[model samples]
Structure formats: structure tokens, C-alpha cells
Target: MASKVGHPLRTLVAFFIVIAALYGLMAITKNWTPRLGLDLSGGTTITLTARNTTGKGGVSATSLEQARTIIQQRVDGLGVGESQVTTSGGNQIIVSAPNVQRDELIQQVGQTAELRFRAVYQQESTTPTSQPGNSATAGTGNAQGGSTPSAKASAGTGSASAGATASSTAKGNGRPGPALPTEPPAPPSPRPTAPGKGTPENKAVEWQPSQQDITDFASFTCPRDTQYYPDVSDQPLFTCNEAGTQKYLLGPTIIEGTHVTDANASIGQSGLGWQVNLSFDSTGSKQFEDATRALSQKQSPENAFAIVLDGTAVSVASVDQAIAGGSAMISGGGINQQSAQQLANVLKYGSLPLAFEISSVDTVSATLGGEQLQAGLIAGAVGLALVILFCFAYYRGLGVVVVASLTVAFATTYAMVVLLGASVGFALSLAGIAGAIVAIGITADSFVIYFARIRDEVGEGRGIRTAVETGWRRARQTILVADAVSLLSALILFILAIGSVKGFAFTLGLTTLIDIVVVFFFTKPLVTLLSRTKFYGNGHKFSGLDATHLGVTALPGGRRRAGTATRAATQTGGEA
Candidate 1:
């Protein structure tokens, strides 16, 4: 079969064009550096063990996987680059993030993310009251400054009153009005009896605070008492918002988070600010409509409901009319894009199937990370130097091809890493670096195969040009098979491995692909072009393809002077 050679120059040009395009994209994105992983850069690593919240004995695989995915989404929502959330043991999840606060990381991933909607029985500011009855009303202070309160009544004070009639504010317009005192006075002797459980028609007014509940609400501070209340759907909750600014005594759960089907954050139709829109299932829709209808008829704070997450009030919005549809919007003074998006994410992903307990929190210092990175680079450099030395010592002039091919492969790999980092949050770790270093040998092996094949063809009495093509035909299959095996192994490893080992597998598979590109496009084309040169074609002594070096009688298809064959024979005999 005739050996078909490709358009070497065109292939070379196309390959370089692709490389140039990668760098161009990097420049456009303004991302000049690769995102390093937790090991390479200082970061926090947390290990979590999943336990079934119910009295189940062991964690199910499906539940653990679901928890990992939810936690991963939460981490990504934080915009932490190169964060990894992977399942380790049967019930354990390993989360690694570069350059993130430990407490923030824990708070984000540790929460069960249970969401609930509860009617606000009472609302009070956490700050100390100046007078006996003076206290900031719930939803009074503007999230954004304005003459009108965002959704609830503005700040005002009156004598202690339970369920006082405070005028309800419209969605976007409402002036400050006299509000019921947030702080309750000392309970009179024989405190009024708590309301009994009533029918659904008057359920909103049925659940009144007991004497204990009222006393606890008065003494309960913002953040100090926030964690004390466990979110039970049947019980009243005394807790504060995430910012610890306002505390609330909330009625029983009106709607559980499970009913929420979708949530998204976007600019309000009024274009005033960002708002989170929510959609609920059919059952939730009816329940919500009923709850809102009843709550809308009540006085100031009672008309407002709190969207609680993990026992903290995310937002409290007043209901002017019955929200009959399955959808609702949470928008107020403090609702910005970040807060809105975070709330949306929580509602969208809902709660995890199982609760996760943080087993260990590990922090890697920047200095130690830097030292490790430096050491890794030094080892890679030393290995590359040795490879270069071996290539030159063995292949002589042909070593130039090996060096050039390796350089192209290295450049292409680096550009890909940087581009992947910017586009897909792929971070390079120490294991990834080691994988790249190992690829040096893999790339060198390809050159060695091709070069050896070329030498065999030359020894079989073929001219340099013919041998170049024929040798490639023989070496191509071997190179492809070798790379395929390597890629398969990497794929398997990536699939089966956990933690940083996946980083290694990813880079290995990535470089293996780059090796194929460099060998087929850059290396072979350059070698083909070089073979057309007189020094190489004539098999000059220093060209690493001399007759003596190749163990051949003479250079095939080369001009010969008088007695050249005689001199070649004499030289071969003398060397023997």
C-alpha cells in the first residue's frame, strides 16, 4: 500500500491556529492565570458525615448523593472557584474550597436548608429599648431609605398592646404610622389564657402565645436566642433574621419548603429592586391562599409572614390581599441581588434528604501551600531537564524534533488549563501537576516510538523521505493504541477515584489528548518538512541519520562521488 502523506504545512498552520485561538479567548476573558486547587492554594477542607434525620439507622446512598449535590450547589452559589464536593465513604461527603472562610463554608454547607412559612405573631428589634414600652416595630426600618416603608408599617410607638390595629402598608408605598409597641410590658397577674385551637376559618387568630412564650419573646435577644429554637412545624418559633437585626415570635408552619417547586431572583417589575419569585405545588397553593386570606384580615404585624430557613427569618413581607396563585414574591428594603439569589437558591434546591454533621475542618495556610507548589515545580523542572538530556544524547540532531514537540504540547496544555479554569471552574492541584509531569514521559515515549520506527525504515534500505512516511505509518497505530490505553485508564480512574485523585486523572486525560494533537499535527509535519532539507535528506554525519549511525551501507537516493562507496565500506570495516 502506498503511504499517503498529508499537507504538512497546512496541518501545522491549523494546529497553531487552534492554540492561538485558545490564548485569544483567555485574553478576551481577562483570565491570564489558572485557578489553583485547595492543595495548591491555601483553602478550607471540610469533611461531613451524612445521617438520616429520621430514626433510620444508616444513610442511604441516594440520600447521601442528593445531599452532596445540594451542598455543591450551595458552594457554587457562593462563587467560590475550584471548589470540590465529592462523596467519600458510604455516608461521608468531602468538600474542598480554595480561599474561603471556614465558618462561612461551614454555614453554607452544614445547614439542612429546611424552609418554612410562618405568620408573625409579634416582631421586635433586638436593640435595647430606651423607654419602658419603646421598641422598633417589625418591618419598620426601610431596607432602602424612603418616606414610605417597603412593605410593613413604619416605626412608631404606643403603650403595650397585643394584636394592636396597625395600618397595613401597600407593597411599594406606605408612610410611617403609629405601630404597636414591640416590647411587651410585665405580664399582669394571671396572664390572659392562651387561645385554644380553633377551626381553619379563624386559624390565623387562634394560635396565641402562651405565658411562657410571651416571657421568652420579651427576654429573647436576637442572635443569642436565634439558635435556641429548633424549627418545628407545629410549635411557635422565637428567632431572628439572618442579620440578627429583628426578632420574631412566629406561629406554626403554614407552608413547608417541600411545596416550593421553583424559585428565581430577578429585578422586580416595578424596577425598584431585586426580588425572589417563588412557585408552589397545587397543595401548597391552596394552603397558601387560605393562609394569606386569613392573615391579610389581621392587624399590622399579624398580616406579615416570615420566610424562615433553618430557624432564621430570611424575609418578612406583609400581605395586603390574598396571594391566591401558587406563586409569591419576597421583596423589601434589604433584598439585593446577592441576598435574593441566595434565598432563591435555598428555596430552589429545597432541603437535603439527610442532615450532615461536619466531621472535621481543615485549613491549609498560604505559606505551606506556596512551599508545596514550589517543590512540585522544582521536581517537574528537574524531570523535564533529564528527559531533554536523554533525547539529545540518544537522538542527536533528531532530538530537536522531540524538544520542539514537547514544547508545543506544554504550551497547548497550559493554555487549555487556563481556559478550562476560567470557563468551567477547573483548578490545578498538586496531583494535577504530578499528572502533567508524568505526561512528560508519555509524550517522550511517542517521540521515541516514531524515531525508532524511522531508524528501522532507514536500516531497511529506504531513502530518508520514503522512510519518514513509512515509519509514520508503522508508528501511528502504536502511538494511537498507547494513547488509547492511557486515556482509558484515566477515564476509569476519574470515575472511580475520589478527592484530589480525580484532579490527577483529569489532567492526565487532558494531556493525553494534547499529545495526540502534537504528534499528528506538529511533530510529524515538522519532521516531514525537516526531512526535505539537504543536510537531513543526504544523511549527513551530524544529522543523526548518517550511514554508519543507521548501520546502513550508504545513504539511499543521495548523490555519490567517485569511490564514495569504497570509502564507506572501508570506514565500516575499520569501525567493526
Candidate 2:
């Protein structure tokens, strides 16, 4: 197991190996690349139209735009990046996501988007450090917290679980993380209400939490996989941080997002990087000021308020002081230009006045798909070239081995992708291509690990042949462990992940296994064969395996960090 893994002459023409290589080479180039998904290739477009219910009035411009925003959010929930949703004419909203999950996405965009103001009552988290102002107590005092039953409701023919619709387009692809809740505010009592009903004075009543709310909060878990927009402003709301780190118990609707008349993302005047500025209408301003003031006075979790949308908490921060101006700014937590814009957009689109009905769903022609396919290929090619060039520039003679091994791995992987696509309906989406690109880094890292190990052996004064064997022994275990971890992660993501990201996980897992095979069967033996050459055995200065450049100095205990390894030639090639 130790020495044999690296042997060059272990077997000549292993029948199946040769046959598979020949067949793969012959079949892989059939189309050269795997099938592209809609984002990379043109796919279908869906058009949904908003129509007001009998008493709700006609679909006004404002209502149409709001419906578009909600529809966009639903299509975006899957995070395919290839999707596009826009409102055309007065009542038409269009969505262009890949046809792979088109039906599912269509149903998602048709639901309603509600805005809510829930007070942080009691919060709990298993994370080690409790955030300032967080309470883990259940139903203690007025602390309140609960979870969204679903992120969306079925608007049309088929209704998927709210979990299915609420899948986050954000990172983590919906993985679990823990978060602590903040300060205690008395749970608002349930008060019968009318939405947007009365003057600001009438909105002053706090809605209370029921026993069901307590049970819901207690059972609430970290990293909620699904979410639903709060349809009723008077109800206790339950939600988790996107990072899954913390949970919040929030009070009633103190301030509706409609209070925010305008929002913009920009760099802070105080040089605090990016921040979001919100301007409010008079009523909105007064209400926001009161809410912020209340939050500012509370303990940590209670001190912080969540800006939630469609069953998700987009942002949460503790108030530092009373924000009385009605206008406010949000900053902190590594918010950058892009993230700030995202925050602003979410806030801007969070509350839409209308819902939409799917008008028609249609497939886009494959005519323009090549552009995305080309882009994916272009990125992969560039990344591949850079890695290969770096190996040669740094490794010198050893660059030959690195390049060869990488080529084998690449060829094998591409062949498998194509073969799988042809036989098992494994279509390659943009995310899949990204996974392959990431694999390039993993592949390069494997070479780096092995080369470093070989250099270590040479540094100890071993001949090239001996170093190769010893290095293989030490490095093989590490490579196996790393590949095992990679495969495990891929398996989990492929199993648990939804939407295109799951395909990304599949590609990742597939390529990882290929790394193991190419490294063991191709990399090890190729290096062994090359070690027999004059340039390498003699430790030519340009050879990356040269002991001196590697800083191998022979130590007093027969140890050497770097040296001329003149005795390297005396060792038999397969001595190990």
C-alpha cells in the first residue's frame, strides 16, 4: 500500500483502463462540453398578469409594480442568476428562469408579499456567546418570538410546501447556523385590527402573543429552511437570521415599511463604508422614530430590530440611540457597496400592494444559449491556463508532471460530465460550471501538497527515487482525507440543497472523486517515470525537485533541508 501506489511498472496496458481511456477520448468530444442551463443558454420566459380582486380596484401602476417586485423575489428565491422578472404593459409581469424548474418558479411568483412589525419578545440560541440583549427564555415577561409557517402561499394550480417556495437565494443555499435573541419587550397582546386602517394613533395598540406563539417560538430552530411572509400585521412573527446565527422575538407592527418613502444606498458621510438612507413620510417618520426609540432602549436582541421581508429577516441591528428624525441610516457588519444596494432593494421592494396571476409560461429558443456556454468555457479555459502556467513558472522541470496530471484529470472529468449528460440526463447549469471552476483550485492544491511533501523528503537528503516513494507514503493519506471530505460535503449538499445549487454540489462531488483517481494512478506513476531522467536524477538547478532550491539542508541526524543530492543517481528507481 505504501510503496506500490507510486510504482510506474505496476501494470502495462491494464485492459479496462486502456479501453476506458480510449472510449472516453473518443466519446467525450462529441459536443466537447456539457449541456448549459437557461442562465448560460436562453431558456423560457413566463408572463404573469396582475388583476385586482372585485373591491380591490383595478391594477394601478403602483400595484402592478409591486406585483412585479414580489414575482421577482419568488423567481429569485431559487438563486439561479439566469432568471429575469419584469412588468410589461399595465398588467403583465414576465419571468425568464431556466425551464428546469420553471413550473415551480411560476407558482412561487404568484403569491402575495406582506409586511409586518413583530416585537422581539423572547429569543433563544445554542451559539456559544450570547449576543448582547438576547434572551433564551420562553414566554418570560413580554419577550415574544415565533416562526413563519411558510414563505409563500400557492396562488394557482399546484401549491408546493412553503418550505419549497421559501428557499433562500442567499448564500448557505439554506444551511443552518445559530443566533441568540436580544432584549425583552413585553409581548404585545392580540388586538383585533384593520390593516392600514386608522390614523397613527389607532396603530398604537400592541398585539399580544397567544400560547400557540410560545409553543411556536420554543420549537423554532436555527437556520429555518423555509419562510412565509406575515399576512397579518397583528400576529406575533417568528423568523431567523439569514446566517442562521440568531433568532428574534419581535413586538407588533410599530412601523410599517410603507413609512419608508424612499431608500438609497451610498457611502456614509462619516466614512463608514456603505450605508442605506431611508426617508419617511410624516406618518411613517413618526412611527419609525418611535419604533427605533423603543428598540434603542431595549437589551441586545430587543435592542435590535429586524428588517424582514417575505418570511426572511434581511437585516437586524441594535439601535444605538433614539432615531427621532423619521429618516435613518443602516450600517455595519461588513456592508459593502453591493450588499448595501441589495439591502436597499429588498427594503424598497419588500411591500408590494398587489399579487399576480400567471398569464402564460413559454420556452425560449435555444438559439442564444451559446453565449452563456461560451462564457462558461471561456472562464474555465482561462482558469485552467493560469494554473498550468503557474506550475511551469514555479516548478520548472516538475511543471511537466503537474501539467500532465492536470490534463489527465481534466480530460477524465470532462469525459465523465459529457457521458453522464448523455446517459443520465445530467444537464450542466451555470452553477455546475462554477463548481468545476472551484475544482480547479482543489486540483492545484493537491499538486502543491504532493510537491511540498516530495521537497521535504529531498530536504532530508534522500535521492529523487527515495524521496518520491517516501513523499507518496506521507502525501497519499492527506490527499485521501481531503478528497474524502470534499466528497462528503458534495454528497450532503447534493442531497440537501435545492435548485441549481444542488447541481453545483453534484459537479463538485463528481470532480473531487476524479481528483483521487488521477492523483493516484496518473500523478504518482508519472513522477516516478520522470525521476529516471538525467535532469531530474542529477537534481538540475531548473528541476523543481532540486534539493538546493527547495532549501533541503542535510542535518546532523542524517536530516537535510536541501543539498546537491549527488547520491540520488546511485539509488534504484523502485527501491521503496
Candidate 3:
């Protein structure tokens, strides 16, 4: 079993097969290189400075890190690969992504994503929200911005409000009944806010709608301009439904998004199209319970609740009952698969401790990265040259094994880097390239250790095959020990480091593992097969394993080399 496992032909064949598979994938995908990091690719880099809205001390490390994680999710949700999001200088979050439009990236990660549960005091749109061809910013039909989570109420289809229709289907039969009747346009409720709104720190009180706020809602179109986007939760908001068919007047925020503990989007309990289920923390549960009970008692438009996100009403429905449990569901026929997913993602990944303002936006040119990349390659070439020179100097014939093994290792590592980039968005940074170059030295050490052991056994009067086998047994333990230390160091570095430094650690660890694979599957077996050839087996003077160079005076068969045989024959003749 051991012999079969280490057979030269078998090992070589398996090695080639793996290389073939990797090359096949590259051929099929037409991707020969790994995805380059933001540093290597020209793209937008947005630096956001987090501010404490409540006038507290600067943000804590924990809060900064939490914000970093959330922002990363938002970028990932946009499907941008090779994006780098990290905290800098404690209070700043830097986002770098490749090939993304400046405006789109800003909208995805720049918003405060302040989710508020506000009451709909007045909805004065003569326009129907269900109207087709809705192209508003918050409208359901806009391809750029689909129905966000708050676009519809969590309340079932029966409680769905105007312009947004939903049905409670019996099962997953793919059939939905007629659109539920939308409430007739009710007279705008008594003014819901005043011009003098309280700051967010002060518990927000529902305000009386000023003449201006009301007029805006009455004439406001769906997809309002950026100037009209929702602001502080203390003031009343005039915004349109995603469909642009309805306008709404929402009172002060009753609850904020931080209260949400978890959220998910899936088919409704009754198999209705889709729903976003929410689970709030203890504090959020009580606040929601109070808000729902109060709204349920109001009449007409006052009875409805609007789920506002980032100052826009994503969803609204009449509160039919008080919800005490921390968990709630948002289901409406308008909540199709795509909209449901968008809503759930926004809620689940939107948790952040502080608001961010983009302080500086810059472009990272790929040209600069390309220059850096060229330097990294030059450095790698120099390092590899040194390693190859040392191998040939120390082990003439055995140098072939070192070079071949390294070539295989290089091929395998390159293929994996490219494949991982394609499949998992693993970007190779400049630091990572440095790590790969360092790997050359690590790989060279293994061959030197193994070849020296072989020479030592041959010096002890062993045949070439015996020496090769015995040398491997002694050298493998040392090889494993050295690689283990290297791997351990790499793991620790990867764990402790952050940002681009992590790229270095990861590439180092990756290449170390590749080195071990090459040593076991290619290096050992190739050297063993090479020992069987006459030039090496007979210990030619320059074969590196030459008996003369290795200081071997006699072979196992009593054949003497390195002048020992000639000396012995001369002495015997003199005695005769």
C-alpha cells in the first residue's frame, strides 16, 4: 500500500490530471487571471466619516466595526465583486469597489438607512398608487429602485392600503385572487405636524402638518427629488408610494430600525406570493405594540401605519390589532419575490450604530495599480531567480526536481487564485503578490532538505534506490515540521491583521499549503524515479548525487568510486 501510494508514475499521472482539470476550467471560462483588488483596478473609493447625531463622544471601536460589516453587506448586495470595506482612523469607513458607477455606489452604501415606523396621518394623492407604469424612486416598477421593504405593509393582504394590492391565496398554487379593494381616498386628516419639530434626542411627538407640508403632499409626484428626501424623524414627511399613485403624510417616527433583531423574506404562511418577516428586540417589541394599539383606534387614514425607510414609505397598512410579540410579518401581493428579497436584505443588513457622511470621494486608477503590479512582478522574478540559483549550486542533477516542482506549484497556485477569484470574488492585492513571492523561498527549503538527506544516505554506502527511499523517510518529518510552523505563523497573521495586510496573510497561507501538496505528490516521487536512471544511479561526477562529491568511498555491492576502487586494486597488485 505504501509503495503504491508513493509510486512515481502514479503520482506524476495524478499531478498532470489535476493540472489538466484546472487548465480545462480556464479554457471554458476564458479567465486566465485572478480578480485584481481595488488597489489594482481603477474604481471609486468612498470615505465616509461617521458622526454622532446625539452629540455624544466619538464612535466606539465596536460600533465602527459593526458599521463596517453592514456597509460590506450593502455593497455585496449590489453584486459588486472585489469590493474592499474597512474602517480607517477609528471613525471613518472606506469603501472601494471596481467598475461601479459613482452615484449607484453612493446610494447603496452612503445612506443612513434610518428605518422608522411612522403613522400615516394623511394620504392626499388623487393619483392611484396601483396605476401602471409607475417610475418613481420608491415606486415598484422602477427598474433602478424596485419596491423596497417599506414599500408595502407587513399586514396581510386584507389590510393592504390604497394603490398597493395584495391577495391571500390558499396555497402555493401560483394563482392569486382579484386585487383586494383599496380604501377610497379619505379627506386629509387634521394637520398632523407643526413647523417646530423636536430633535431626535427628544422623544419625537406627532406634529401638526404645516400648510407647506400639506401642499407638498397634495401636489407631490412619486419619485420625489433628492431635495425632498426624508429628513429628521421628528418632522412630518410628505412622500409618495413606490407606484407614484399615492402620496402620504407621516408623523414623527415611533420606532427606529436598530430595534429589529432579525428579518427574513419568504412565501407567506398561507402560501401567498412573498412576505418579509420581522423579529424585534425587547425594546422594539414594546414600542411597536404601543404604536399599533394607538393606530388601530384611529379612523380612516389615521388608522394606517407607514413603514418608512430612509425617509421614504416602502409599505403601509391599517393596524387591525396590537402586536405584542417581538415578531411580525410584512406580506402583500405587491411583495413579489424580487421586492421581498430587497426588503428583507435592507432590514437584515441595515443595522448600523451611527450615521455616515461622505467626506471624500476619490477614484483609484487601475493604471496606478498596474504600475504597482509590475513592480510586484519584478520583485517576484528577482526572488525566484535567487532561489533557482541556489538550487542548481547545491544539487546539480537534483536541481531539475526543484525547478519542476516549483513550476507545478506555480501552475497550481495560479489556477486556484484565478478560480477562487471567479467563484468567490477573492481579489489578489499587491500585498498578496508579495506573499506569493515569499513562497518561493519556502518551497526551495523543502527540496534542499530532502536532497541533502539523499546525499547523506548515498555517502553511507546505500544503492541509489535505497538511498532515495531512506532519505525521504528521514526528510519528510523535517519538511512537515517546517511547513507546519510556516502555516501556523500564516494563520496567526491572517487572524490578527486587517485590511490589505490580511491579503498578505491569506496568500501566504494559501501558497504554503500548495507547497506541501507539490512536495508530497511531485517532488518525492520525481526524485525517486530520477534515481533509477543510469546517469544518476551510477553516480556520474556531476550528477549531484555522485559518489565522489557525496564522499561515498564504497557502494553496497562493494564497488568503490571516488578513487577508492583504483587505490584498492593497486594495493592488491603490489602485494601479489
Candidate 4:
């Protein structure tokens, strides 16, 4: 019976077709290179230790994992590719981002993300008064803060609008209160509260600044004074917007981040610029409705509510009328698509379950990363060279087959790595390089197994052409089982391991798959075609399969002299 090996020519064509498809995709994406990991491309690694703000005994695994996920989202917002955020030692979160600014990465991932909605009790410019004991004047400024010139609210549409460069001076009392203090007071006590805890009676309009609160507000300065005050839910907050151009005295938290169900950035209903639409849960909707109703009855700055994040006023929007819907929109001149999306992401992801203290920050320089990359490449090259050398020394002319198959497999693996990098943000780390090197041995082993099977058949009297098919039939199962085991191990490692080790498992599995592809489509077909050629089919001396080399009387299927078998047996016995 004839062994059924599929059409070699068609398989070879299909393999090339797949390669062409990969390159075609690369052309479409315009990304020809794989993304490098932090160790290879230089970046910052931040380690944060989680601490329960509620005075709990220890940080729970659930909270640490939740914090890691939130930090990952924040880092992803920065558009950094190949960023890694993982939990470690139960209470620590490790964040690695390649090619990111250190300060920016720290800011994004390190924020406590405590979001609160408070009524604006007072809004003032941070510009110092010209003379001592004089009231400071409000200056018109950009969206980050200063003075909003005008603000309009569409009653039930869940949208509010303010000028980008508007002066939002308090409407009723235009006089600034007191002279600014040259120095800020000592930091306030730690007044942390459960994220979303607040009562209905502590409405936005009800909380008035106490005598001490007024003193703190008078002495506070934008940017500098922010650190002194703790932004607790039930207490007043004195802080500035992110830009530090405007200062605000805010009432207790009216709504917390936990109540926000969803947020998205889009063009406003008025066809203005960008805005962030916020959705709230049932409790948040009721609280927002009540706050808006009361605030709409007040004057300009008093009518506006401050959207505070991490004790900083991100936005202060005035309400012209009651907004009773379960949704609200934040629109201002300074809110472009980028800022809107950023704000939306922060709100959408909500606050981390636990506060984190940055434990350590380590940065890898580009020069060091380049040096490490060069070392990894050198190691891989050395490994591949040794593999090729062994094949040539042992298999003679058959080494050419090994080299060609490896070349095809390498091309396939490179293309896949590049594609994966572009598509899914996969990065190649040094550990991943080690995995590829190990795969080199696995691939070479496959070729050795197939070739040995063919030699065994030829030694048993089968022609090379016939042996090609029979050898493949015998070797295919072992090759598949071996590759399958490698792939399985890689999958398990990838699932259980963290940090750079996952990179190793990823590349190992990727190369294992490419090994199977090359063996079935490229290597087997090439060997089958070579078996039909005169040089290999004739079992020439250099072909590594001659009768003399195999210790047989003559080439399989050829006539032998009467004494030839006797002489071959005698020589084989003498050599043994």
C-alpha cells in the first residue's frame, strides 16, 4: 500500500502563501518591528505597596489585584505600549512601562484616584494681591481653572457649558476676602473616609465654611496649599485645580466616584467641543439631582459644583437650573478630546480599592538597555551557530535541509512576533530571547528524528524515495507529541507566572507552533522533493546515506554480489 503524504508541491505553495499574507498585513499596519520590553528598550518600573486606609490589619489579595488592574488602566491611557502591571507579595503592585516619561508614569499610576463631587463655596484666583491686606482679583484663564466668564446649563439635558477662557468670578460677592499668607499652615490631620460615604442632609448648599475653615482658605495658595488639607467626604476641602491657577473652598463630598457607573467622551449636544458624559447609579442620581436643584438657586460660583479628584478641583461648572436626570455632562473650553477622554477614563475606572505608597522607582537607561539587547542577540546567535554546526558535522549534505527549514521557521516566527507586537502589544524581552534559543534545539531535534527514521528504513532495504514517506509516517507522531508537550508547558507557565517570565512562555509557545508549521509544510516537503533528486536518491557517499556509511552490503533495492553481504557483515563485526 502506498503511504499517503499530501501533495508536497501544494503544501510548499501554501506555506509561501501564508508568509506572503503575513508580510501583506505588515505592510498594511506600517509596523515592521516588534515592540521591545522595558529591559530591552529602557523604561521605568514603579513598585507600590498597598495600604488599607480603613485601618485594616493587612492588605487583602482582592484589593491588591484590584489596584493593579486600575493602575494598568491608568498606564494604558498614556498610550505606552508593552506596559506591565502585576501584583506581587500579596500587598505590592509592580508597574513597568517602556519609553515613558518617569514623572508622567508616576503621576498616572500613583494617583489614589479619589474622586468627589463638592459644592463650590468660594472660587478665587491664585494670583497674589498687589499689596498686603488687599483683596485678590480674579483673572480670566483656561479650562484647568481661573475665572469662568460664563456658564450655561441645559436644564434636563444632563449637559452644562462654560467658556474655555471664561472668567468664572463669583456672581454675588465680588470682593476678595483676605490677604494671602506668605506661608501655608501645617498639614491637616488624616481625615480619610470610606470612598462613597455621605449623608443626604449634608447637602452641597448646606455646608458653610467654619471660622477655622475660613482661616485655612485665606492662607491657602494654589499648588502649595493642596498638600496641607485632607479631602475627606464629610469635611470641607480647600484646594486648587490641577493647573494651580484657581483655588476653591469646597463643601463636603456630595457624590463619590463609586457611584459613577459609566463615563464617555464625545462631542457635546450643542456641537461645541469635547465633553465627558457621566452615568450614575440610583443613589448617585438622587444625590446629584438634589444637589443640582439646590445649587441652581444660588449665584455664579456658588451655583457651580466642583468635580474634585485627589483633592484637586478638575472642573467647576455652574448650574443654571435643576438637573434631575441620572446623568450629567462636564463641558468646558479647556476640554479637548484628549483631556475629555482622560477624565472619562479616570471616572469610568473609579477609585482603587486601597491607597498605595510608592515603594521604589527604578529606571533603565537606553544605553544599558541597548547593551543588554546586544548581549541577548549574541547569545542567540551563538546557540544557533552551534546547532547549525552540529547538523553539518553529523548529517553532512543533509544539513542543508535543516538550515532551510530553520530559515523558514525563523521567518515565520519573526513575522508573527512583529504582528503580535503591533496587534496586541506583545513585547520581546531577554527571557523571551532565551525561549527562542531553546526552541532552536527543539526544532533541530525534530529534523534529527525524521532523518534517523529515514536512515533506519534505508538500512532495512527500502529505497530513499520510499523511505521518505515511511519515515514521515513513523516520525510524525513523535514530533507532534513532543511539540504538544512543549506548547502545553508554555501555556501553563504563561498562566501561572508573572512579570518577565510570561514573556519567556509566550515566545516558547509561539516558536513551538512555528516548529509544527515548518515541519509539516516546509521541511517534510523539501525532504521529499530532495529524495527524488539523483544526488540524494542515489545515496552518494557525501549524502550521509550510502551503503558503506550504513554498513549495508549495497544501496537498498540494488543487486549485490554473492560475497558482498558476507564481506559487509564481516567488516561491520570487525568495526564493532
Q: How many residue pairs clash in each candidate at the backbone level?
A: 1, 54, 21, 8
- Estimate, for each residue in 510-534, the C-alpha lDDT of model 1 and write its tens digit: 9999999999999999889888777
> Candidate 1: misplaced stretches above 4 Å?
1-7, 45-73, 76-96, 120-221, 224-230, 261-304, 318-362, 366-372, 452-463, 466-474, 545-552, 559-576
Tens digits of per-residue lDDT for model 2 on 1-576? Answer: 345533464632352385387466646556556655665555678777777642366789887876676656645534444355667888888877663455455435553434344444545443323332211111111101111122111112132111121212211112332332334534334433334542232243343345545545545555542332233454455666544455555555566677776666777655756766677779876676566555555443455455554444545544444556556655544567755655555555555565556678887766555666677789889988988888888998888877776776777777777666555446677778888888888877888888888887776556677777789999999999998999999999977876578779999998898888777777777777777777876677787766555665532123332234434423422122
Count backbone overlaps in model 4.
Answer: 8
Which model scores highest in lDDT? Answer: 4
Query: How well is each residue in 1-576 modelled by candidate 4, as lDDT tens digits?
Result: 123345787789899999999999999999788888887888898999889866578998888888888888877765555578988888899898886777667767777768788887776666533222211111221121111223346333243332122244321233454433446665444443454554343554687665566656666775644345766778778876655666777888888878889887878656867777778889987887778778878755666787777777766776765566577776653667766776677777778888778899998666876787788889889888988898888787889999998888888888998898877678888888788888888889899889878877666556678778899999999999999999999999998987788889999999999999999989999888777777877878887667765566676556662255445435444111
Give the better candidate number (2 or 4) by TM-score. 4
Which residue pairs in candidate 1 have backbone atoms (N, alpha carbon, C) closer than 3 angstroms, thus clashing? 143-333
- Estimate the lDDT of model 1: 0.72
| Every candidate's lDDT | 0.72, 0.58, 0.69, 0.72
Task: Name the lDDT of candidate 4.
Answer: 0.72
- TM-score to true structure, per model: 0.71, 0.43, 0.71, 0.71
